[model samples]
Target: MVEPLPHVREIPPYVPGKPPPARPGLTSYKLSSNENPYPPLPGVLAAAEQAVASMNRYPDMGCALLYDALAAKLGVQVDQLAAGTGSVALIYHLLSAYCGPGDEVVHAWRSFEAYPIAVTAAGAAGVKVPVTADGRHDLDAMAAAITERTKVVLVCTPNNPTGPALTHAEVATFVAAVPAHVVVVVDEAYLEFVRMADPVDGLALVRDHANVVLLRTFSKAYGLAGLRVGYAVAAPEIAGALRAVALPFGVSSVAQAAAVASLAAEDELLARVDGLVAERARMVAGITAAGWWVPEPQGNFVWLGVGDRAAELAAAAGDVGLALRPFAGEGVRVSVGEAEATDRLLHLLGSLEPPS
Candidate 1:
């Protein structure tokens, strides 16, 4: 038997959400993964059905139609877009193409779980920059951590577990200070949920900085997580590099078709985004009023810094048939679902009264 590479041995496996157990007479609300509780829009469903006629053939290896459609929507050239199974896959491709054994990749700890995984899979050194006291990226410190050995750096805006996004000026400062040789990725997984006046415009930065790559997904606002279609907007050269490392026909024809159709229904999707924002506001308001510690999360989820009471709160929530994701040492990350589910979660929190 062949021994695994040293790098592979050192890598830790990813810990994903665990499904709540099926308890007798208890109905569970799954708000673990940050998914849209809403179903796919009618137009997207129709497009998927239409594309099912030709599953016999392989997907378009070039993803020409999908690239063209996204380019038109994003106002970028076709060559500047590269489609992936998901934005996370694009992240992996970027790391594989730009990073190696001796290189260093820096990202905020507890941001996106995939960042470290991708960096290590590429045989690169993973440098974790801690989040600020309030759970936002420390951009100045991240920039300071950079060195000649750093090949790439990731900025997860509206960060996953704790979600306060960086401002435009802050992003500009960090981007400008980084060395030209290091690739910078702005993982805007929850960009649409941001309603603040001056949230950083990642696409604009992509247009201005050739070294920067903007990653987005249909999984979030588009309600197409099952479709697994996401894309990266970057310079043509960088897009080409991603394509080179990406597995052939990485995105399915159906996924491409569905994404194109979803783009056409942008108005409807935006409306759903508004609904999530409203729901999130309600969730935060309810939790804060109830006197449990909750962060002002900009993402679709809410963070409760449970501290030592983390397990107890999670257990209490479970007893009431609400499924939440506990981030081990960190707090619990609860996704905002539909009205009914959100109401149920609020009711659960109120009833629990986890000790401070």
Candidate 2:
């Protein structure tokens, strides 16, 4: 019998959010994946289409043009960047480069599910610090969890599943307290949606700290979820290590073209984010007036702490041909979709009876 490694056997598979269920007559909306509801911005789709002609050729392994453009935009050196299939892929690459058996990766519990998956795959022990009551990272606890065995510390601002973000002062304090040897990865996957007061500037943190890495993706705000592409901004040495583990030709030419176009159309694309922000506020307001307790959301999604009724809560949304993300007994994450989805969800979610 072929047996896998112990760590490999232990890892729970990474499950992408369930797709929108079929509705015979009524229009259904999927608010499960925290996906940006909008389509590609002007020029973005066209750039992607144009790149189709080059499908016969392999993608630029170094991602030269993308690096040049992103470097100029983020005000970072080209060598300080490494593109990957997605930020999650980059997360895995980070672990692959730095972690092995007996090493540890520190992150918050009930945060991004990908963190634990990657750590397990790398044969690294995961130290999961629980979040505060309101769905915010307990930075103090995370710092306390660190030890000589810790190789990476992941900070997910505007934390997934539950959408509260960390303030600048909070992250600064945590960053200062953490040791220099451990790589602190600030995953800013949905930072474009954050509008909280005193927001953490991830790039600035990376610029100042040699051990800091800011992992961001075009999947959310850029509306490029279908075409996988994300990048890490870090000190050249760290960036080089990430590149060392990256799958060659991992980022396709189409994705590269689309990302460059999205940057060129940044103003217009961000305007769409403004619309989503407004919709998010509307979602929070509607959910609150109905009597359920939800944490203030800074991302393009809202988290309902449904606890044991998570499946029941998701079923209620499903009844209206709307799909939501449920973490069993934890909570439900509803993405900010079109106005109708929000309107219907508010009306339906309030009516869901708690499961005994």
Candidate 3:
């Protein structure tokens, strides 16, 4: 067998959230992945269907329509935008463009799981700084971790699994502290769900700092995870570099149309986001009321830091026909899904003895 690179041998596999197991009588809910529980709106569905008619032909390689729509919505020049299969793919593109053997990418540990995978695949070293006790990024430590070998730094706001978001002041300070040569990627996959004051303004960061890049997606908030449409906003030079390294025709026609339609109907789509945010609030309130300390969740999910009992609680949820994502000895991440899921989760957590 042809030998693969030594780094590839050490890459940890990404464990995605599992589907809910069948229950004979009870309805099962999948609160494992932080996915939008709602189905796509009619207009978005129709757009995707229409695009399907052109399946025999290839999609617009440049993603012209999607770029126009995003430019109008984001007020950024089209030259600054680069779309890919998903934000995860964009991460790969960025790393591939800027990193090579012996280079370093700094990010918080327990952040979006793909960070390490993408970094390794790019032949770059990953420098992981641990999150604070509250599950928020230790921005200062992340800054301190940077060195001459560092090429990229990722900051996932309203971070996945553990759900605390960075404020504008926090991100701004961190950006100032980072060297001008390092790329600061602000991943905002759950931006629409954020209700916190002083949220990190990714656009402002991208505008003010040439080294800053913003990654956003339609997966979580727009219910287009299956279609895999994500984009990056950065300085024209960096965005061009990403586009240069992108896989041709990555964003499918159906996905592009659906994304454009979703953007056109932003207000209505965001109304659904509002409902999910309410459900998140209820979940947080119930968990805290039960005496369990949950990180202040700004995304469409909550984190249960049950320590060694993480797997136990996750198994308990499974037995009740609910699927939640658990990180072995760390904690369980429960998405704020349907109201029924929230009720079931609250009941399950409420019944258990709160973690000491």
Q: Distance from true position, residue 271, model 1, in Å?
A: 0.7
C-alpha root-mean-square deviation, candidate 3: 0.7
lDDT string for model 1 (89-108, tens) is 99999999998999999899
Model 3, range 1-356, lDDT digits (tens) per residue?
A: 99998989878899999998778888999999899989989999999999999999999999999999999999999999999998999999999999999999999978899999999999999999999999999999998999999999999998987999999999999999999999999999999999988998899999999999999999999999999999999999999999999999999999999999999999999999999998888888988888888989999999998889989998999988999999988999999898888888889988999988
Worst window of 10 by summed lDDT in candidate 2: 347-356
RMSD of candidates 1 onward, in order: 1.4, 1.3, 0.7
Tell me the tens digit of each residue's lDDT in model 2 across 99-196: 99999999998999989999999999999999888999999999999999999999999899789999988888898898999999999999999998
Best by lDDT: 3
Which runs of model 1 end up more than 4 angstroms from their true locations? 23-26, 353-356
Residue 124's lDDT within candidate 2 is 94
Instruction: Write down the TM-score for model 1.
Output: 0.96
RMSD (CA, Å), candidate 2 to true, equals 1.3
Q: Provide the overall lDDT of each model, using Cα atoms, as 2-decimal numbers.
A: 0.87, 0.90, 0.94
TM-score of 3: 0.99
Question: Which candidate, 1 or 2, would have the higher lDDT against the true structure?
Answer: 2
Clashing pairs in 2: none
